[model samples]
Target: MRGGAELSRHTTTVIAGGGVSGLSLAAHLAVADHRHPVVVVDDGSHPLDDRTWASWSDRPGLLDAAASRWFERIRVHVNGRTTVIPLGRYRYRVVRGSDLRSVVRRYTDPLPHFTFHRGHVDRADQDGVVVDGDHVRARWVFDSVIGPEVPPPSEAQLGFRGWYVRSERAAFDAETPTFFDFRTSQDHGASFVYVLPFDAHHALVEHTSFTASGALEIPRVQQEALTEYLTEVVCTGGHEVEREEHAVLPLHAAQAQRRRGNVLTIGTRGGLLKASTGFGYQRIQRDSEAIAKSLRRNGHPFDLPEPSGRFRMFDAVLLDVVTRESAQLERAFGALFRYRTAEPALRFLDEATTPPQEWKLFAGMPAPVYLAAAGRRLSS
Candidate 1:
């Protein structure tokens, strides 16, 4: 404590970042408990922008009605062939940042026990969060300010650059989305292009890479990739880009700090982002809900389910393969999708598959690389 610094406020919970993860936990807590107030603190440096979160679900989700697009099948390009995987009971949905912000606000804004505290947090811990030399005391703190906690020198990073585009004529099939088109150069890393078509003339096409180098090309390279794809692949004569979005996410084995006293990390910082594929929307949702249920039922949010050890091994090995064999990323994925069905793969990636199911899925994979990677990880 500074000589003159004092406790500025006291709340039941202090969320250190007002991004999706922090606000999500706040909303969950506020709804589950009425006596305890939840406060979300933020620096507001990041304004809501063109980012989108995409996930698939067998049942309806909180933001499904507001989703920007939906697809029931995924088309994959691998080994000079195309494979279409049908999602039997699941549907893929893309939710925009603005929509997610509004949805969560509708849940927190009207509650008297909920508050949105604005300012940059200098420090956050179990005792409270310090902002502008004033400390806000709280019983618990959910921190999402990642900083340097993720993508350590040992981890891989996923980089992306994409555009929301409108073609001059009918150039896309609105019903299906290209989950992965591994036609891009692999010199940088495991790179692929994906298209989320909203209609015959409009889509959000992007190029994403999983790399250990953590490097991405901007206007020159990104623009060229899209131009070539739209012209040759989409067979389009002309197109206009409505918006461009770029981002990077850590691809590392997530180690959630759930047992820590009153200071718990959430979201990407908490290891909710899957290390192998870089997906996290559904994982974050599951974690937030579990945390709230634990707090409501057990009087503590730390009562959460443990991640499977096998999945941890799987994620680690796949990440090793991605980094070691960047040039054959498509081949590894192709082995998994050889069944022409995506439901099992989705469940496996979601970490909900059983041992037998997992075995069947991996049996078709060309396993020499995976075995070597697994051996190295296990020995180390």
Candidate 2:
């Protein structure tokens, strides 16, 4: 029973890591069956406390009801210049993790077949997963707990800080969320400021860095950088900070393999994350949906399927190119925007929709540089 309250003693599907991916998978499994026993284990260090999950989507799903804000235009800035890209039919939506948890709990709490345990997963093995010496057996185990080590084959790190602030005066447009304000200097790797304006006077401002390696004073640096940007670029002076949000995500272009016997990887650990953008929320949802569909169709546990081969190859080449030459990112991004429609580009990044001609155009941009980087990575 996936959702029934009756304890089955032992479960068939045991998921380790109760974050977005794990919880979502559990919910999907529950919806699929009322008899498949599913248990989710969390170490208590849930990242859901202070993070915002935002992604571009044409259709709505789990987080649709919790969407606090949305925008159709994303502003990009580079070296004091700004470009506003209209999303056309696409909308960039945001939903806080706390809200997501609340929604999942509402549905999952009633089900007897679903159980959530608060504990640490020490290690995962071929048979099952070990949680604080308690061995839990399952036909399939989906793991989402990945640590700092196990670097992606070829990837870069991006350190960033997000702050939710209430301004003293109304300074932001309530209709549009400033996706990337690239007006800041690109000297320290590639730096940018993003604003997710909740209303006219409140927004989540973040200072982001696309660099290889560095220790950052997140709070101090974010405040300072934000203060400077607000006063200079945004011209929103004398604003008061009310609340803050911060995080560091590795923008790695790593090739992740699936399968450890019956144990399978999910979420970022499963290479469901976008290598270039560090966007995993939508990808996680999509991956979980696919897995659920597979389970329903197969009527048994199975090994996880790999992501699109073409997408992986493209990401690998792009990552190699970016790693070898950081300066080309801005140009590459600019070309992508200039050549392709915003909708298609967003779809491509989300791995939802892509056209063959668009891919051709993508490969054509910076042909010499891309080819060289691809060749270098392949040879290496």
Candidate 3:
């Protein structure tokens, strides 16, 4: 990929890194019929992998259309207790990554205003983005490139490996999803098992851990734990693993909103990820819509609302507690669900809780531990 030939053309908006965020922005912009010409740049290095994104929402949009499974109840297991939390009006849904990409492409591929380019963006400045040594001047550049990740003061990474397995007989309750199972070992950070059952015979069993980001052995340990879970708890009669998935989640990391001239960051790079839980599918949707609205209404993409500081503070406090007080983690989470209920806790994590609601939710936390963590964060 060279610079000179491709530099001849320019676009009004250049969306760098055509992953979920970029694809989402382009899809929304095309759907709204934005007047500006948009170009999506990529290095064509995205691996063909199977992955699933799960989130909670009331109304379905592009994500719902591509979803393969939905659940009305989530179960949380901790301290030898099981809690089945109903999803009242909202639905817990899972969408395949392949399907999401296909759905987005279907909307943008035929649109004349959108163009997909195959190359790497060298640099983005206030003026434009440099691709293959050539410059493509644009009014605004939306960059989703995450250079290097470093966990915040909390220093916790949520690592997990999941297997899509099929059992020989009925072994799962398809209507309910295991949101968290803390029955696994918690020695290497806060460890848990998560399961999403598609049917009586098939399910995705995952082992997740919250530990230091530098812990290289976390993945292997989590995999071992997942196997133990299958043998002891899930299915003893035997099961065959069909597909495997793994991820290292940056839990509650601080993100700085940066702009290099006209380059505005989006996606994980722009602090779109929910710091505490490592969930960003819904955030991506909301952010893409905001960007599209800005472009359509204000003729610029940067005219957007600021993220909530209070929610960010809350995330920081939780991350602090998770990393600093791993032993008390189970008790802390148990109290949260026990006091706040699943829906309110989910809403709080989703950053939708108001002042009064926040107080009510906070009532369930272990008072001294969280208060100390909050004090440390505030003093810092």
Cα-based lDDT for every prediction: 0.77, 0.71, 0.77
Candidate 1 residue runs with Cα over 4 Å from true position: 1-7, 146-153, 213-221, 254-260
Ranking by lDDT: 3, 1, 2
Weakest 10 consecutive residues of candidate 2 by summed lDDT: 1-10
How many clashing residue pairs appear in each of the predictions shown? 0, 11, 3
Model 1 lDDT per residue over 240-270, tens place: 9999888787666646554356777888777
Q: Which prediction has more favorable lDDT, 2 or 3?
A: 3
Q: Give the candidate number with the greatest lDDT.
A: 3
Question: Could you give me the TM-score of model 3 versus the true structure?
Answer: 0.91
TM-scores for all predictions:
0.91, 0.87, 0.91
Clashing pairs in 1: none
Candidate 3, lDDT over the whole model: 0.77
